[model samples]
Target: MVSKQAGVDYTETFSPVVKMTTIRTLISIVVKQGWKIYQLDVNNAFLHGDLHEEVYMDAPQGLAVASSRLVCKLKKSLYGLKQASRQWYDKLTEALHSRGFEHSVEDYSLFYKKSANSSVYVAVYVDDIVLTGTNLVEINNLKSFLHDTFKIKDLGQLHYFLGFELLYREDGVLISQRKFTTELLKEFECLSYTAVTAPLECNLKLQAAEGPLTDPTHYRKLVGKLNFLTHTRMDIAYSVQHLSQFMQDPREPHLKATIHVLRYLKNDPILGIFISNVPDFNLRAYCDSDWAACPDTRKSVSGYIVMLGDSPISWKSKKQATVSLSSAEAEYRSIRMVVGELIWLRRILIEFNVPCDTLTHVYCDSQAAVHIARNPVFHERTKHIEVDCHFVRNSLQDGSITLPCFHY
Candidate 1:
C-alpha cells in the first residue's frame, strides 16, 4: 500500500504499541486469577478515526460524480494515510477515558479501570484489543459499547492475536508462532530441511570479512524473520542478535549460520514459552555475561531473563556498547542492565495493582560482581564501571533490588 505524502498529505504517524512483555504478563495474570480474557477487532478501524487535517483523494471508479477531475475530501482516516493509526488510537483513547479507564504511564497502549469489586485491563495494538478482567458483566458492557461506537467484532476467548497463537490449557497458557514459523520455512524452502539440535554452532566465530559475500538483502530478510521469532522462542535470541550485526553486508558464512538457525526452528516450531499458573507473583532476575565474546569488537555480550513467578516475561541478549577490562566488570554491567529491566517491570506490576515484594531478588554467578555491588570498596578495580556500580548500588540501598549470589 502506498502511504500518503508525509508533512504534506499528513503528519504524526507514530502510534504506541503494547509491549510483548506486557502481553505475556497479562496472560500470566489471567491464568493465575482465572480471569476471563477476550479479544476485540475494530472493523475498518482506521476508517473510524476522524481526520483533523484536511485530506483529499481521487474518486474511485463507478462513483457518480459531476466532474472526472473533481476530488473527494476525506472526513475520516483511510488505509494508506500516514496519520491513520494515530487518529484511530486517539479516538479509542477518548472512548476508554470517557468510560473511566486510565492510561498506563509505563505502557501507553495499556488502559485499566479499577473499582472496589472489579478491575478491567484493556491493551490496544492498533485495531486489535486484548481485554481481561474479573467482571464478566462489565466486559460484556464494554463489548457492547465498543460495538456501538466502532463496530467492534468479538473474537471470543483470546486464542490468537498478532502472530502469537495462544493455547489455553488447564495448567497454563502456551504461546507460540507455529503458523508463522511454518509459513516462514515454506517461503524459504527450509520446511523439508533436516532439523538441528541447536540454533548456532559452538565456538562459531563469524567475521565481517569471512567467506565470499552473499545477497545482503536475502540475509537481512532471514535475520529479520528470525528476530521476530525470538519473541516467543528465546532459544534463538542470541543467534538472531549475532546474525543481525551482519545485515549491512552479510557474507556467505553469515547466511549459512542463519540457515542453521532456521533448521533449529524446524525441529520444534510449536515449542514456546508457557506462562504457568503459579500462585506466587514475586519477580526474580538472572543475568550473565561472556567476557570478550565477540572476536571482531572484543565486546562482551550481556544476557538476562526476568521472571514473574515461574513465567518469563522479559529477556534480552545484546552486545555491550564498550569493551570491559575484566570479567567481573562484564558481569557487573550485565547486572546493571537487568536492574533497569527489574525497575521497569516493578512499575508495570504496580500499575496492575499487584503486590510485589519489597526487594526483588537478582541472581548473578560472579561473586566478584556481587561483592562489588554490596561492598563499594573495590575502587581501584571498579573505577571503569563506576556508573553501573552506582546505579546498582542505589537500587540496592533503596530496597528495589537485591543481588544474591547463586551458583547453578
Candidate 2:
C-alpha cells in the first residue's frame, strides 16, 4: 500500500523502530510503581492519519461512481505511503499534547504527565498504545478521552503486543514470546530436528565459500524473521548476526547453521527472557568478543548483555567493522559500543524518574581490555586503534563508567 502512494523513488524511507529494551523498561517501571497498564488498538490505524502529499489512488472497482472522472485523492494517510507512519505519529502527538501530555525528548513515542495527586504515562508504537498511571480512575478517564478523539478499541489488559506475551499475575507480570517461537520452529520445519544445548557451536565457523542456497530468498526471509526474535531471545542474537553476514550470498552451510539454530529452538520453544519483580535496579553490563571469529573476513564478534537487577533487558552480538590485532582490542571496541547504549539508557531512565545510581558498572572478561579502559598510556600495541576507543578511557577517568571485572 505504501509503494503505491509513496513513489519508489522516495529516499530516506526508514523510520525508527521501538526497541524491545524500551518496551521492557516501560513495563518494569509500571510494575515497580504498582500501576495498571491498559492496552488499546486503533482500528484501521492508517486511515486515521492525514496525508500531506498529493497522492492519487484508483477508485474501487464496484464503488466507483460513473460521474467520477478523477482518481481518489488521499486526504488521510493510507498504509503503503512512505510518510504514513510519520503522519500518524504527528497526529497522535498533536492530540496527546493538546490533552496535556509531555513527550520525552529522548524518545518521541514516550509521553508522561505528573501532578501532585496523579501521574499518567503513554507510549505509542505506530498504532498500539500502552497506558499506565498510578490512579485507576485517571487511567480510565484518559482512555475515555482518547476514545472520544480517536475512537480507539480498548484491549483491556495487554495479553500481547509486538510479539511479547504479557500475562498479569498477582505476584507480578510475566512476559514471553512462546507462541512466536513455536510458529518459527514450525515454519522452518525444525519441529522434528534434534535439539542442541547452544544456539551455535563455539568452534563452528561459517564462510561464504559454500555453494549458493537452492532458495536464497527463503534463507534471507528466515534470517530476517529470526532477527526480530532476537529482541526477546538473546541466546540467538550471535547466531543470527553470524548468519546475516551472508545474506547477499548465503551458502548451504550457512543455511544448515541457520537451521541448526531452529533445531535448538525446537527443544523449548517457550524459552524467552523473563522479567520478574526484582527489587535491585542496579545497572550492570557484561561484554565479550570472539577474536577473529568470522571465517571470510576474520573480523571479531562482540556480544554483550545489560541486566537490571536479575532480569536481562538488553543484549547484542555483531561483527566488528575493523580487524582488531588482539582480543583486548576487540573487547575494548565492544565495550565502547555497550557503553554508548548504557549512556543513552541512563539518560532515558533519569527522565522517567528512575533512580539509576551514580556509577554505571561495565563488566569485561578480558583484564587487558579493562587495563586499556583504565590506563591513559596508549602503548605501541594499542596505538593503532581509532580515537573513539580512547573515549572509554576518558569516560573511566571522568568517573562516567566504572569498569569492574565480571565473569560471564
lDDT leader? 1
TM-score of each: 0.95, 0.92
Candidate 1 stretches with Cα past 4 Å from truth are: 1-5, 64-69, 212-214, 386-389
Model 2, 252-271: lDDT tens digits are 98888888888878777777
Candidate 2 deviation (Cα RMSD)? 2.4
Please give me the total number of clashing residue pairs in predicted model 1.
Answer: 0
Off by over 4 Å in 2: 1-16, 64-69, 116-118, 169-171
Best by TM-score: 1
lDDT of 1 at 139: 88
